[model samples]
Target: MNLTRTWIALIALSAGSTALAASGLTGRAFALAVLALAWVKAELILRRYLHLARVPAIARGFSLGLAIFLMLAAGLALIPA
Candidate 1:
């Protein structure tokens, strides 16, 4: 609920993801899923920690940026180029 707990949860999620990647399950689909989760985490931070919802425009912009970055990075990583 609070920022600290949210951060801790995010860290835990990331660590778990890293462990999964290390376990030889690394695939583009899984990585894309992780990126989606990253976007969710970012939105949570903006809403819960930054109180972005208090300012609708800022909230939208911040979340949009987060989504864009996640999608782009994850998509690129998923590519075999």
Candidate 2:
């Protein structure tokens, strides 16, 4: 994606996350939804701004690592705290 489009997407995702936070939802589902939005925003920044899309192998590695970390975070978020 182009930088302009990526920027717009990031903005939209931020808006969505903010809306979700203000929607009075709670629990694991809400946490996962916010985290998913965060994942997309991170991916866009990584690919477009960081120019990682040109390197498919490195991009996949970073994306996979991020996915693993987010999954673990999601799991932890599900635990009572």
- The runs of at least 3 residues in candidate 1 whose Cα sits more than 4 Å from the true structure, single-residue gaps closed, are 1-23
The digit string of per-residue lDDT tens for model 2 on 1-81 reads: 789999999999999999999999999889999999999999999899999999999999999999999999999989987
- Where's the lowest-lDDT run of ten residues in candidate 2? 1-10
- Worst 10-residue lDDT window, candidate 1: 25-34
Task: List the pairs of residues colliding in candidate 2.
Answer: none
Q: Pick the candidate with the highest lDDT.
A: 2
lDDT of 1: 0.79
- For model 1 the TM-score comes to 0.69
Quote the positional error of residue 14 for candidate 1 in Å: 4.9
Q: Rate the local accuracy (lDDT) of all candidates.
A: 0.79, 0.94
* Candidate 2 structure lDDT: 0.94
Where in model 2 is the C-alpha error above 4 Å? none
